[model samples]
Target: MDGLTGLLDGARARGAFLLRSVLDPPFALRIEDRAPLTVVALVRGAAWVVPDDGEPARLDLGDVAVLRGPDAYTVADDPATPPQVVIHPGQRCTTLRGEPLTSTPGLGVRTWGTGPDGSTVMLTGTYQLPGELSRRLLTALPALLVVTGDDWRSPLVPLLAEEMSRDAPGQEAVLDRLLDLLLIAALRTWFARPGTAPAWYAAAGDPVVGPALRLLQEDPARPWTVAALAAEVGVSRAALARRFTELVGEPPMTFLTGWRLTLAADLLREPDATVGAVARRVGYGSPFALSAAFRRVHGVSPSEHRIGAATGD
Candidate 1:
């Protein structure tokens, strides 16, 4: 656990702070998000986002919206009309008077942060590094969390403020990690408190299903059978099947099959491998069988995936 904990310790990512504006009615966070996701807790006013293939959603103060993937969206006041974009990161510090990523009804303060070189506004001062309890508490948290409103001036608030400032040696790394933990803690609290959607974060502390999930994710290609899995994990097959379906919204076997094929498709994209080789690696007996399943799952054949990968699609 220590080695794995330290694995992502040196994982450096860039942080940015830009305040600019664009004239266009439809505005958005144009720049690609960092490898690490961006967490924004709007301090003032409101924001709205139109996700691709989804309905427009409004965000209020104390609301934290996250985009885990790179998809262009229109964040606006009205869904019918485009909103002006301003204060986008790209336009900030650029020579040209670039259009803002999002329109600002008025000048607002947004604290944008990344690895280093990112500006973090500290409203309060002081941070507390508790012992093993803190680490355990952090690990028990959900993936995303938002703490908002007047009551934010709690003890954690001052600690967060101090963590934002460069006051101690190695503090940058320490504070960054602390912030990550704090965010996780806040999110965990949110999930347990309810009104949250059912997402991956909901799997945190599920007694029966969580262990099974860890197994599947850690070894997607395992020759997992309902009986084998149940026996290994010290549960009856019926119980494992019921619990998996309840938490994951899919049966154990179904999830395993999809995960195996996903890995197989990835291997098929490798320049060195033939379709036949990828099939064997993913538990398929032959190229024809793999192709049938691939086409059924992905619409495209393995060959097409290879072609797309080679052509930079």
Candidate 2:
């Protein structure tokens, strides 16, 4: 798989938190949900996203903003507006003093806000993704990034907006899939802009290195050496090493070890998965060897990771 696709593969939304917020003027919320990733798309009127550590950005109609979190931020009619509500973990909304804010009522399915006819209409999708694979891509994002509707054109905003209000069998699953697609589309456009994409993502397009990367990702279990990879891609071993490092910012084997361990780490999250089986699947000959490498990189053994994953640590 290509770099972008592989990174996004780890971010698929399943039973994601979806909300359609309808707000009138003079509304602001201090968001501290600690969700790993969030997407906000404006369908009508406008809003401002104020990051705690960065400049505020305005989202006009059809605009989308991605917020990488754990850090707090604000969304409001104006950047200077004081937040009346605080969104804590579990999406619990309360007053600034922590008392539950119960004045606003739900408008409809998956919809909540101040009023039903509020001028500012926006759709929000929050992904509380688990596993190291998700963080692998999220770490590349800035605290906040905005994609203007004018620059990148996609019908997902409207489509997702339409889907948000539907109430039917398996509607949650449908919304999750739509949210995932919207996120993927927005990220693709955002990363395609000049110099915005991560180095690894940018390198995925290199004619020489791209094939090698595909080979590695496609069959990470293979006992791949630098010379074998170079030969498969029709390049000298030294040339492949130099170019792969130059483009992907790491030597091939270093990257492979990381990929294998990332896969192993995620696989360990499965309750039925054994350490030895996971080790073999990711190219390690034995559980002991895989545990050694995993500990060196992640500072934890596979069993420890599995326990932490199970307990949501």
Candidate 3:
């Protein structure tokens, strides 16, 4: 159910990118220093994208990359041999095409970006994450992933393409959300690959562990004991622990604890949910115990989590 649950949640957190003419080029653009979780999809022509820690990569249509850190990187057509004339972040962008992309009066939502040849080479856009799970996903994604030219018939892509032709109300917000879902699909498909990946990603490949993970994800507070869970899948507790540790990098209980805490944190963020309610939801009988454990893990109490979460922390 973790995979299915992830799919559903991902469908909700989707976002998008639209290109307006004001910033159209004959000019260049850079990230301008301040770092945010950026998902850049090259929906048009190919360009050279340079990350701080990595070399310049060729980003073409359907190519997606997440700029993990805030380090500024140059995304331009040419390999900045001498680099372009630079300016400060949030300061004057000295690039010739400094006009506002969205301010272009004739630009429409169903419109597209124009390439150097005046052809719609790409439909590029960028977005940031909404939830912690999504943020973690952004961090975990490879620096560059090009999903183009039949890289699986992505439902997200068609959704994006179809949206571009519609004349609906609140279309921009709708497009952005759809873009976020595309990211989740891309991430999911990436993790479904085998060999050489993080433990959690690799865990998706283990027959028993995969099912077990789904079970845990389905209901974190279901009084799941190691012995019972192991037996449910016809393995001894020790065998289950060994397999889980090998693939998931933590014993089942430890993984469950972390997952429960994540759910508990989400619950704590709810305005109507109290400490005791969150505690019970996460499998604890006492708020005191949950608070103590939560503080030990998060360096704050349930109350702090509620307050911080309420304020969009």
How should the candidates be ordered by lDDT, best one leading?
2, 3, 1
**What TM-score should be assigned to candidate 3?**
0.73
Give the least accurate 10-residue stretch of model 2, judged by summed lDDT: 128-137
Model 3 lDDT on a 0 to 1 scale = 0.60
TM-score of each: 0.48, 0.91, 0.73
* Runs with alpha carbons beyond 4 Å of true place in candidate 3: 7-28, 32-36, 67-72, 79-106, 109-129, 132-144, 148-150, 155-167, 196-198, 269-271, 300-313
Summarize candidate 3's per-residue lDDT along 1-313 as a digit string, tens digits. Answer: 4553443352233333343212233334555534334555555556666766677777656666555534667666656633343323332344434544322234455442333344223343453223323333433456555444345455565457667667788887787777666666665556656642456656865888987887887777789989989988888899988999888989999988887776776666555888898888878879999999989997989898777644434
**Model 1: which ten-residue window has the lowest total lDDT?**
124-133
lDDT of 2 by residue, 1-313 (tens): 5678777776667688898999999999899988878999999999999999999999999899999877899999999999999998888889999999653555888887879999999999997655423656676688888899887889899998888889889998899889988888888889889888877678888989989988987788899999999999999999999999999999999999988988787778766999999998989998999999999998988898888755446
Candidate 1 Cα errors over 4 Å, as ranges: 1-46, 51-55, 60-64, 67-73, 77-204, 265-281, 306-313
Q: Count the backbone clashes (under 3 Å) in each candidate.
A: 21, 0, 15
Better of 2 and 3 by lDDT: 2
**Which numbered prediction scores highest in TM-score against the true structure?**
2
* TM-score sort, best first: 2, 3, 1
Candidate 2 Cα RMSD after full superposition onto the native fold (Å): 2.2
Candidate 1 local lDDT, 198-237, one digit each (tens)? 4323553576776776676566556778888888778999
